[model samples]
Target: MDSILFIEIESSYKAIPLLVFKRDHHSSIIKKSHVRIYSDAHALLMAIEEQVQEFQKLIEQQTIQMIEDKERELNEHISHLQASAIHQLTLSQQQWFEKAEEQLNKLLDAQEKRLSEAIADARNSMASAIRNRLIKMNQSDSLIGYLSDALHAELNDVEKSLVIVKSYSDNGTTLTIENDDCMVSINTQELLSELKSCLENISDD
Candidate 1:
């Protein structure tokens, strides 16, 4: 085995090579002194130490750079995730609103249909009641007699003679009075029209 010896120079605070020793097969130690060889060896060791320090610094710089790149990538990914989440939430809210509006429109349409049916039923019931009442009045003999007397009073001044007639049919009643110069007729339809107008006026009041 061969061994290298190092000695420190107090002026430069650097380690310099001093001697090389080796053992022969007989276990005898031999020492060789060569100042130029030892100086070259010391310079080589210093260059190797400098290279190792430079490599360590480079590794530290690369590590820092890698950490920064990873951090930047993570931040970008987080931002993308947040943007996607917001878009999804907005889409969900829009869908909910559309569904709610559709339901509301259907509800309103159903209510409108029901209301229209109710109005139609009420109109039919009222018309039937009016028609039955009018039929009863038409069958009464007292009503015919009263109408005749009223026509006689109205036509006293203008007529040579007046004839009054009462008629009843499925459509309703008709009252007719005729003279030589003029004729007048009244029907249940005309009475119904007058009654509707009066009812509208009363509602407005």
Candidate 2:
């Protein structure tokens, strides 16, 4: 009779698809098989081998289930974080863009206002200059006529025979006159200055 015994068995797996979820392809399996006895063994040894295979299958199934759950949870968490970050970035960019546009519009408005004022000032200054030039031109023509007419009219008027040429200066107008009693001489600038002083004193009063 054989007192010691030896036994051998095989173990493997076959994937089974779970059809519970319509959109997700999740897979799980419940393995079941009759042990094939390769060599005759004692009853005690056969029982131990069966228990070991069952234990191994249960451990493998539990471990794979845990790993799949953890991986799915991790992927979902990462995707959520990425989406949240993108949303926050978009919001921040929109806020900054609005602020920048507002500031730019304000600057443009201020610049336009300054430009308008400057253009108005330039127009006013140009109008003033043109008016002054016209007034000065009229005054100059009148003064020239008066100076020439004074000398010509006085010289042409019939009086006496004697004639006198008066003093001359480069700064102002010169006049010549002849009369019956005495030919008089005068500087018109001094007379005009005295007349202007008298008018100014009257205006002050």
Candidate 3:
């Protein structure tokens, strides 16, 4: 069934005018259509959320790169220092080498601690910032607008014969149809769908 319909086929008639309103077809087409619409909406939202997760992954990759760079630089510095100390020292290997090694170890330990703390602090701050940004995006008015925009695009041109208008207002978010015979009013929030009083005409008499 089309998301919007302007006419219905009656027996062998062509282009029979139809006024489909809500509260009709409760057990059938309307229910399925509502479910389909919501499912599509959820899929789109998840896709957008995946982008956020990808951004977090990028942050993690950059952090790891920074740690690797720092470690490489520190290793090069330590290697240079150890070589210089071993070559320039005047004392015997047993005494002077021992002292040089001890001092170098002390310097390496201090430098490693500093680097670890800096990386830890940076990672925490970056992760916190990402979470905060995502929270803001989820909670802000932007989310509503995004939902409206995405819904509009996702459910585009549902029916060529019917004119559909998506509106967002203080009252509610709705999809309205301009049809001479049938009026489709979809409360995008509640998203209830049905043909109004369609069962009233059913008669056994």
Candidate 4:
């Protein structure tokens, strides 16, 4: 693969859309057809981290090899030019040296630019992958059914006249419940009925 990648998927029952990783385009095949599967936040992140380490090591090795090869090539070229200049007219040989020097300089500049661009592109892709991984990791995995049931039960104890409700998330539950009815227009009977209906629906499920 040209790049290392991972995938994650999430589905919700409350008409919520399936959540898929924003990145990851690697392909696989099964049964003569392509198949794409999902991974959790933890596994996806670990894969990315491992890929990053591998890329760094590859880059380092390539850089060392390029440097050594370029040095040896330059030295050989310089020696050849010096030998030719010694048998030629002085002024003619000076022009050859200048031309060769400029050529080498241009070659070095081009190589440096190419390397810089590749590294920058790699960094941008890695950042994007890491960002997506973190978002998935932070997302809560509690089922929507569980959350709805729990919230409905808690709302039952709240008075009908109350306009605002708060639940702490420190214990992994934080929600805001709002009662639109004013105190003067409080319908305790209707609120109790609604709560009962919700409970019954949960039991049926």
The most accurate candidate by TM-score is: 1
Query: Which residue pairs clash within candidate 4?
Result: none
**For each candidate, what TM-score against the reference?**
0.61, 0.43, 0.28, 0.27
> Which ranges in model 2 have alpha carbons more than 4 Å from their true place?
1-45, 134-205
Candidate 2 residue pairs that clash: none
Q: Could you give candidate 3's per-residue lDDT for residues 1-205 as a string of tens digits?
A: 6676443324532231223324364432334454456557668879989998998899999999999999999999999999888776644666778999999999999999999888777766665565455444443455455554544454453445444566766544566654454555555334211211221122110
Whichever of 1 and 3 has more TM-score, that candidate is 1
Which 10-residue window in model 3 sums to the lowest lDDT?
A: 196-205
Which 10-residue span in candidate 2 carries the lowest summed lDDT? 29-38
Sum up the clashes in candidate 3: 2
What is candidate 4's TM-score against the reference?
0.27
The deviation in Å at residue 31 for candidate 3 is 99
Which candidate leads in lDDT?
A: 1
Candidate 4 local lDDT, 100-190, one digit each (tens): 9999999999999999888777766665565454334332433323444444545563333433343333233233444443212212233
C-alpha RMSD for every candidate: 8.1, 17.8, 67.2, 56.7
Q: Clash pairs of candidate 3?
A: 21-195, 21-196
Worst 10 residues of 4 by lDDT: 28-37
All models: lDDT? 0.69, 0.59, 0.58, 0.52
Kindly list the per-residue Cα lDDT of model 1 for residues 1-205, writing each as its tens digit: 9987664334542343223433355633333344445557779989999999999999999999999999999999999999999999999999999999999999999999999888777766676676566557654666566666766776673452666777887665677887777777767556656766654454344
How does model 3 fare in lDDT? 0.58
